[model samples]
Target: MTIKKLVEQIEAKKSFLCVGLDVDLEKIPTHLLEEEDPMFAFNKAIIDSTHHLAVAYKPNTAFYEAYGLQGWRSLERTIEYLNERHPDIFTIADAKRGDIGNTSTRYAKAFFEDLQFDSVTVAPYMGKDSVEPFLAFENKITILLALTSNAGAFDFQTRSLEDQELYKQVLQTSLNWENAHNLMYVVGATKAEYLADIRAIVPDHFLLVPGVGAQGGDLEAVCRYGLNKQVGLLINSSRGIIYASQGRDFAEAAAASALSLRTQMQQILDAR
Candidate 1:
């Protein structure tokens, strides 16, 4: 889908929420373990319950990779289900994959073609050659990792190089890449203070921001600095929403959690 369509969805739903499908079998309700594909079953339940409340669903590839063949199958089925039933909802493969030229091409194909995700997260340390391949796909976004939510981000992302923070350089340099309009970014909400500077670099591009709920990132602070006229942010809440309950009412609890965030988002939109 185009970024225009994504913006339309956010406006129509009064939300820019992206529900993370980082499903952990151990954390899911025990009852689902009996299903032929417990991971997909749990994901389906959450997606069905909260589809109206979210504009995107991100399934970190590691979750599926850990389970081997069955896990991969679950991931495939999950994407197919979303495409068939909720095609409007943006899909992200949070694989964080990057490699040399040829390798990155295959990685892009795996997600954008094989899995058919609307976007995927990629590490940009390998420079332009590593990311340009993903941008080749029309209408597909390549969300490069910038300042992340994890504590370890400060080690390199914030370090000054040539009198500029490395992350800032990444954003500035990306503008020169081919088809840069198809590019988005992963800016961790935990570092909300950095959003202002980040936005100054690329104010119109979409930001796939995680660390909002479970990691205690302030939603208001993120929006104060990050939101564009198009609502250029997808605030994700994984464990905080999907695992709101472990009992029979798990789906209901998940919906409640999503609703709370969506309501807050609506207020922000109205204020805008």
Candidate 2:
């Protein structure tokens, strides 16, 4: 999906919520396991229940890869279902992948062409050559990992080089890459304080922010600094929404949790 369409969805729904479909078999309802594809079933229920409240759905690749071929198949079915059923809703393959030039192109093709995800998360550690391949695709976004939610982010992301943080440098340098306009960034909500500075650098690109719900990041603080003229933020809530209940009413419970967050987002937008 184009960024314009993404922004339109956010406006139409009054939400920028991105539901993270990081499904764990053990945590899902026991009854779903009876189905041939439990992961896809769980995802379908969640998406159906909360689709109206969210503008995006992100399925982290690790969850599918863990189960091997079956898991991979489940991921494929889930994306196909979304594309077929709700084409307007943005889809992301949260497969934080980046490698050498040729390898990165193949990875990009796998997610962008074969799977047909609208966007994929990428790592920037390998520099421009590794990431440019993914950015080369038209209408597909390459969401680069910037300041992350994990505690270990300080080990490298925040480190100083010539008195500037490494994450800032990544944001600055990435702008010069090929098709850089298609770039969005992953800025953890836990690092909300750094957002003002981040916005000053990019100013207009979208940010896929994780850590708002389960990770205890403040939504108000993130919005205060993260929101741009176009409302450029995709706040994700994974465990907090999807795992709201493991019982038979899991999908309903997920909808309730999503509604709570979406309502809060509406209030934030109204206040602005």
Candidate 3:
């Protein structure tokens, strides 16, 4: 979807909430295990229950890749269901993929053509060449990793090179790449304080923020520094929402959890 379309969805729903569909069999309701494809079954229920409360759904690829063929099938079915049903809801394959020339193009095809994701998370460490291939695809976005939510982010992302920090350089350099306008960023909610400085460099681009509920990243603080005129924030809550309950009312509970975040988002948009 275009950024304009995404903005419209947020306005229509009174939400910029992006639900993370990082499904885990061990954590899902045990009853879902009885289904033919437990992972897709769980995802279908969650999407059906909570699609209105969220404008985006991100599925980290590793979770599905780990399950091998069965896992791959589940991932395929889940995306198909979303595309066939909730086409308006932005889909992100959090693959964090980057590779040499031809390889990168194939990766792009795998997600954009085969999986039909609107966007894919990509590692910026390889610089322009590795990322531009994904950007080459029309209307598809590459969510380049910047400052992440994990504790290890500080090790390299924050380190000063010459005078500027590594992550800052990554942001500034990426803008010069071909099709740079198609770029969004993965700025973790835990790194909320640095958002103002990050915004100084790339203010208009949407930020796919993780680390909110379960990770204790302050939603208010993230918005204070990160909100652009378009409300360029997709504040995500994965485990905190999807795993809100492990019982029969799992879907209902997930919707309730998502509703809480969406309500807060609506208030923020109202005050804006």
Candidate 4:
């Protein structure tokens, strides 16, 4: 989907909620274990229940990759199902891939061309050559990792490089690169205070924010500093929503959790 369409959907739904599908076999409802493809079954139910409440769906590739071929098939089917059923919904492959140019090109093709994801999370540590390949694709987005929500982020991202923090330099450097207009950023919600500075550098680009629920990132704090004129934020919640219950009513509970976030998002947008 085009970025314009994504913004439109967010506006129409009164939400910029992006539901993360970080499904783990051990965490999903036990009853789904009897199904032929438990992972897909769980995902299918989640999508059916919460699709209306969310503008985007992000599936962390590692979850499916861990299950081997069965897991991969589930992911493929899930993407195809979403594309066919809800083509308007923004899809992201949370793969965090970055490598040399040739390798990055193949990775880009694998996700954007083969699986047809609207965007993919990419590591920017490799610099322009690794990221440019992904940017070459028309209409597909390259969401570069900036300041992340993890504890380890302090080791590098926040460290002073020259006069500026490393992540701030990253945002400034990336903005000057070719095809940078298609770039979105991955700024963790846990680092909400840095967002005003981050936004000052790249005010118009959408930010795909993680760390909202399970990671203890405050929604209000993130919105307060990160929000832009276009509602340039996709606040994500994975465990808090998808694993809201471990019983047969898991999907219903998931929808409720998602609706709660969506409602807050609506208020944020209205207030803006």
Where does candidate 4 have its weakest 10-residue lDDT segment?
211-220
Q: For residues 42-102, could you state the per-residue lDDT of candidate 4 as single tens digits?
A: 9999999999999999999999999999999999999998999999999999999999999
Pick by TM-score: 3 or 4, better one: 3
Which residue pairs clash in candidate 3?
Answer: none
TM-score of each: 0.98, 0.98, 0.98, 0.98
For candidate 2, lDDT tens digit of each residue in 115-216? 999999999999999999999999999999999999999999999999799999999999999999999999999888999999999999999999989433
Q: After superposition, how far is residue 32 of candidate 3 from its true place, in Å?
A: 0.7
Q: Write the residue-wise lDDT of candidate 3 on 1-272 in tens digits.
A: 89899999999999989889899989999999999999999999999999999999999989999999999999999999999999999999999999987899999999999999999999988889999999999889999999999999989999999989999999999999999989999999987889999999999999999889943349889999999999999998899989999999999999999998988888889998
Which residue pairs collide in model 2, if any?
none
Ranking of predictions according to lDDT:
2, 1, 3, 4
TM-score of candidate 3 to 2 decimals: 0.98
> Candidate 3: deviation at residue 68, Å?
0.4
What lDDT, from 0 to 1, does candidate 3 have?
0.93
How much is the lDDT of residue 248 in candidate 4?
Answer: 97
Q: List the residue pairs that clash in candidate 4.
A: none
**lDDT of prediction 4:** 0.92
lDDT measured at residue 240 in model 3 versus the true structure, 0 to 100 = 92
- lDDT head-to-head 2 vs 3, winner: 2
